[model samples]
Target: MKLHLASAVSRLFSKILRLHYSFFSGKILSVRAICTDAENRIYLVRHSYTPGWHLPGGGVDNGVSVEEALAAELREEGNLQILGKPMLKYVYLNVEGSRREHIVLFTAQVSQPDGFSRNFEIIEGRFFSMAELPPDLDPACQRRIQEWVIGEFGAAAW
Candidate 1:
């Protein structure tokens, strides 16, 4: 009986710890590729869980720096070599109702790979001309991309 009680107490403590982490300590930081090719097309990936296209990136793992996470995500998702440093870092809330507090958007350039395979997390990836992009990208992603492009090209904002 003492052993069972001890086990129960341990389980209860574990549950409490998990709850605390989920509610207060959950953090997600990710690097997004703005991958622009020579023709100025932006690379976007389709997520397996969502309908709209998104930037190719994923959550940073614990103990990994942002740059390290970005490099790993780019290799895992796009199979392309990242060129140069990240263009931006962003912090935002998770729209899916998680306690995750941040997403770091790292703009990167990639040399188009001869071929690439999508992991189960991603369904497909392709480059889209700015004018030809789908209308339903994540609002935050679209805004960030637009701002970057405008800033890079010195385009007038209406």
Candidate 2:
């Protein structure tokens, strides 16, 4: 089991390195939000291109603020409206993916719009209770939830 886990980790790093070389260069900034409703249900989205469910977010444009990027991503990906000031949770240095890549994560209480339909970029967005999270949830998102919501902060590479 340990061997399998190590092999999987190795392959993941290999892929990350390949991606970095092919697509990414210089410093990269991105934003992700942990959007929860009054019922404490977490909202997550599955992208058409990506394989797993994750926090709704995208890259921060060259001149855009992180807050603006977060808001835009929440609205576009999950139909989420921020109810209050989003609290900064953590800034993770995604060194494995790209040495200069950083992910700015925030926690926000959000409200979903009346009707949310799938679009080209996002295939699905749903609020899932803690006990009912999707099996294919992104590992990075899981780590954020554990650290921010469950207060299980650990030494982890995000």
Largest TM-score belongs to which candidate? 2
Flag regions of model 1 displaced more than 4 Å: 1-25, 152-158
What is each predicted model's overall lDDT from 0 to 1? 0.68, 0.82
Candidate 1, 1-158: lDDT as tens digits: 75445555656765675577577774646566677776778888776555588887776778998788878877777676776766764555555445454666666767666657865555577888989998988766687688677764222211
Candidate 2 collision pairs = none
* Candidate 2, 8-96: lDDT as tens digits: 66567657765865475677888998889989999999765557999888889888999999999988997889997998877888856
Q: Candidate 1's error at 2, in angstroms? A: 50
TM-scores for all candidates: the values are 0.71, 0.80
Off by over 4 Å in 2: 1-24, 152-156
Any idea how many clashes model 2 has?
A: 0
lDDT (C-alpha) at residue 76 in model 1: 75
- Lowest summed-lDDT stretch of 10 residues in model 1? 149-158
